[model samples]
Target: MKAVIINTSTDSELVSADVVELSNEFNTFAQKTAESILAMGLTVAKAKRLSASDFETFCKLIRYESDSSAIRKLEQIGKRYDALHRHVDKLPSAWTTIYRLCTLDDSAIDASAASGALNPTIKGSDLIALCGAAKSSRGAKNAKSTTARAPADSAVPNGTDMVVRFTTTIDETQIVTLRRVCKLLREVDAEIALSNKLDAVLNQAVEMKEAA
Candidate 1:
């Protein structure tokens, strides 16, 4: 295949051998990075000469912002390097797509790519949806027992106004805090309902001035 280069700065197109050379350079760099990250992860995991528990100290010594962030970067590189380089080599700079793909196992990612579950454009949400759907389908297949429930009575209780149910996503950290908050609220005042607290917060927000 002929190599093509679109020079945005020069307003000229070079279509010959530069494209292939550029692709080769990119692949080499990506492979090196992936290998280095894999080595770093191994080093972190097996710290013979370093303290494993003090991640913050280790990060500072290595010039990283945080240990967790560095570890996640390593994970992303290690998981998606082969797939990204082999299938989506044209867009070597698409870190977002690579990171999204890191959420799934190699088999799930390969299946999604091969089955057209992944869009050509590869939006983050699309990858998330594909991974989630795959996980749900697997869970359904592995489920051994099923429970069937009858439709509940729609009538409200004598003292209650109504019942509300909804679905939403919450971050892991936030959900932990929410559970703690609920537990504390129950322990402090069993009669004070969650709806009451929600209403109170809403009213307070309505009456308060915006933060300057």
Candidate 2:
């Protein structure tokens, strides 16, 4: 396959050809969507090598959502698990599940695979929980800076007492919108947790109330 080089000209012909070919191949393996997605990821990563603008163009050409996390996640999966060609069948069919698996370190991945936790039957939520556990464990091991801890503690006035829990149900469409908003928020502040995001919004609301 000839590599598609994205440039200022945009090379629409080459990009279009690659997209057609990849989409055709993906359709051929509809039953094995995960494998097809990985293949697409590899191709997308190669095609978008020039720049972020090139990537956005590529996404547009493929009719993908602008700034889709799916594109980034697929690229990461292709790069990280490229060596596991023979073990592809063992991987989960859902791209989101594979994305979660990709977030895990090699040791955690290996351990999960060895224990059957990384099988095709695994749920995305379970994989998310696994990633969270791994992240928390790593954070605990690496958190030696009191200064880092102090800022977070000082951010909230009453610590645990300031925390409040509320529950609400959202339909599928609303859930999708919420996820997109969360993604945008993360782009603005990558380190902010979802809880902190809510707190920031609430704090702003309180300030608005005081001004009124």
Candidate 3:
């Protein structure tokens, strides 16, 4: 008679293997869902048949109801799809990174692609840094005009502090980008506050004069 062999693996070991398999399956499903959503959003935007209200209603019917801001970003990505399609395979899986890519002009996008910065393996933070670098380069090009207008724009009445306040909503991606900007401003000794509230002390003129 053939000997019966007992399973050597413990129950915990079997469970661990199942967990890893489940995680991989979940990740695959999530990636596919993200791709599908983007494709649907692009189609809707390209069609241009839906009004703002109509889009919201459609989203409800599809159970894809996202906030207006997020919907807007998705639409923007769709609008820029022509310039982006070539790099689709290399683009990061995260929709946030794709949105950030939309923020860049075609030329910058091309440059980033040429530099291999748009690799699928690139992190969202790395993409943000690339966007920041592109923005800084553009800012440098316009620095002279910006500096020329700064004095009048920043003037304040004597013996009184000037505080400008405004409110707007931002997403997680924007928050990360803002934090990076705040860090750079701090490094330049710019008087800026970053918390639940943001306050700018308008010390740019001082910094410019000092630099000159």
Candidate 4:
């Protein structure tokens, strides 16, 4: 990990003397996931980790660009242009992470349909809609639809699981790669966040100095 220090007194923009690169966030990522994965008594191979890109890629794989027709299908309503291109503010929507995690690309999306260790049937869209707006106004009007095959699973339009299954096959290498990718992504994200905050503070200090 590396860090940077900003010198407010000079025209020089970034003062690197005090900078520190943080490698521990990755460790934190490992720690958090380790706690969860290990608590379940599951194997803690390197493949269990996830990269941010991996997450994003998986998300992109499962997510569909919302159009009017798709929105209508989700909302279970007639085609209404007003329902197009809405936002869902959620961490891990049920339609993707939860759905994929449990079903691993199966036909059993509904909790009622399967008996597994993970029952993540909560509607991600429902939760996202509630974040900053009223449900009736924010969310797609129709019931949530499975936009694409959940992540790792194939498009089994009809299978035992609704989406993907926990039994989904991921080799040891993939799991380790996932863990490393996620850990690095988290570190990068945190560094970016910290950099932004530091920039803001430096700018504020500069402004105050000028005012003085």
Runs of candidate 1 with Cα error greater than 4 angstroms are 1-63, 66-71, 90-93, 144-212
lDDT by residue (tens digit), candidate 4, 150-202: 65555555563455434568899999999999999999999999999999999
Q: How does model 2 fare in lDDT?
A: 0.66
Candidate 3 deviant stretches above 4 angstroms: 1-38, 144-212
Residue 37's lDDT within candidate 3 is 38
Top candidate on lDDT is 2
Q: Report the lDDT tens digits of candidate 3 across residue range 36-141.
A: 4356446546433444554444444334554666566767877887777767767777777788888788988888888888787888889889999999987887
Q: Cα deviation in Å at residue 95, candidate 1?
A: 2.0
Ranking by lDDT: 2, 3, 1, 4
Q: How far is candidate 3 from the true structure (C-alpha RMSD, Å)?
A: 20.9
Per-candidate alpha-carbon RMSD to the true structure? 18.4, 18.5, 20.9, 27.2
* lDDT-superior candidate, 1 or 3: 3
How do the predictions measure up, each by TM-score?
A: 0.37, 0.50, 0.49, 0.26
Q: Best TM-score goes to which candidate?
A: 2
